[model samples]
Target chain A: MTETGEPEIDLLSHYARSLGIEVSGFEDGVPVLCVSGIDAIEGRPGHFHGGATSGLMETAAYALLRLALHERGEQAQLKPINITVQFLAAAKKEPLFAKARITKLGRRSANVTVEAWQEERDRPRASAVMNVMIARSEPEAT
Target chain B: MEKEAPHRDPANVFDPEKAAPFLFAGGHPGWLGLTYLGHGEDWTEIRLPWREELMGDDVRRVIASGPIFSMLDMGGGIAIWTRARRFVPIATLDMRVDYQRPAGERADVIARCECYRTTRSAAFVRGIAHDGDPDDPVATMAAVYMTIGDFNPAGAKND
Candidate 1:
């Protein structure tokens, strides 16, 4: 647990790491992900690809779900059920930031919302809502 | 300073198959390793092969949902272009993906997208992602794309 008593997880070793995404610490008790826009992720000329932006937001949601599970002391497999993404603005070639919040957490599923921003948090380039299915781990034999 | 917009020939028919190499060569699509499978009048298919580095959960060996989203988005966009028969500047406004099941650990995922409807400014698309079998899809997706500029097939530039 960190200063806020939230369980810490090493996200850098995940798939986002392949795209140069890194954990930038926590904000308001939520993990934030950051990624630098490079030529590999560019779409049209000077703009960031919509797919990359969506990927960043989804990764944030996954991290949030993982943190939630850890906080609840539940060991289960998390699987994505669905995800909806809205592109509000054309992402520019700059460092991007993303954070997620759990909207609902039930025994068998979870709902999470995430936002990706370039500069100001108020100005989000893209946002996403995801539903994750939780398959609880079976108790180990005594 | 104001810069000139890229030239576009609206009359040029959009051939997604022929343009696949250039479109997926150096960007996110390229990074995801999207390959052109085939295309029809208003539909296109693309594939994403499995790779260890693309796994979201290392222990589970499951691929991340992000790359799959990228693949479907590209597939959907290509479907729209094929339906419109012209390359126009368009932006994805909103997209929703439903994962029916986790993709097979060692199987390549394929997405087939169809542009079902289009208006002056918006195109509606739907698709399915499957691993070797269309009947058993890994995910389903619905999306909308909005045309940014005038649809001047003759004057639109292909970038």
Candidate 2:
């Protein structure tokens, strides 16, 4: 739980660890996550696949949402309502980076903006806006 | 007499023309085959083989936004993997998608993304999915990826 009174799920940490992402450095606001490369994730003739990038974007948004909720002293599970993104460029031979921030924070919903870049941050390869709905934290009926 | 057809490539590979058969299926009634076409420098493209199972409520119709979103999720994952320096299966923390227009009955869906920069703890990435039509789009999305280890692009081993 954070000072705001919300509990942290360590979403980024748990998720990245499961995927074998090796990352360093982190701040309370935003953090950088990493993953390794493999054949199952190849795109086109031989470049990096795009689907992978989309997954990263979606996951990042979730992580950010979790953080925000924790800061507000609220207990809630975040569900994405919608997301819009534009592919400005491509990434060839470097680890992709995602930068996320809250665009709108409401009682029932939250909006976030995320940018993905390859080697350079100035020239974003892709950008996205995610809309999320806050739901009561409940375990799925497994 | 019944003759059997030769074993060709799996329904899903990366053929743009054949992709329609897979992508156009919409949310028919069965599983479909798809793949990544690879995007720009750090992005990834997800391609699927058009299949009859994609038919939707309209019979001759394609899949629905729900299924399309599922495909996007897969595509997005591939995009992140493309940018990853090492071999790891990253998971989606959360994602949201907006449908600009219904997906056309042509070409495969290329979900391009890039995990360009990573801070000390969080990895940021963004991407888009296009079936070729730049003027219009089937859907657009953005998401964030979290890393487990120290992201090392220079330490990648391409298979």
Query: Of the candidates shown, which would achieve the greatest TM-score relative to the real structure?
Result: 1
Q: Whole-model lDDT for model 1 versus the true structure? A: 0.84
Candidate 1: CAPRI quality band: medium
lDDT of each: 0.84, 0.52
* Chain A TM-score for predicted structure 1: 0.90
What local lDDT does model 1 show for residue B115? Answer: 97
Taking chain B only, the TM-score of every model is 0.88, 0.62
Candidate 2 chain A weakest lDDT stretch, 10 residues: A13-22
For residues A7-86, what per-residue lDDT tens digits would candidate 1 score against the true structure?
57754435688888877878776889888978767777788888889888888887788787887888878888999999
CA displacement after TM-score superposition, residue B116 of candidate 1 (Å): 1.0
lDDT of 1 at A74: 80
Among these predictions, the greatest DockQ belongs to: 1
Cα DockQ of the candidate 1 complex: 0.65
lDDT of 2 by residue, B1-159 (tens): 001111112222233323333432322111335654646545556555544334222322443343455566555554454454323334445455666655566345555556665543345666565667645766666565554454444443332
| DockQ per candidate, 2 decimals | 0.65, 0.06
Any runs in candidate 1 off by more than 4 Å, and if so which? A2-7, B1-9, B152-159
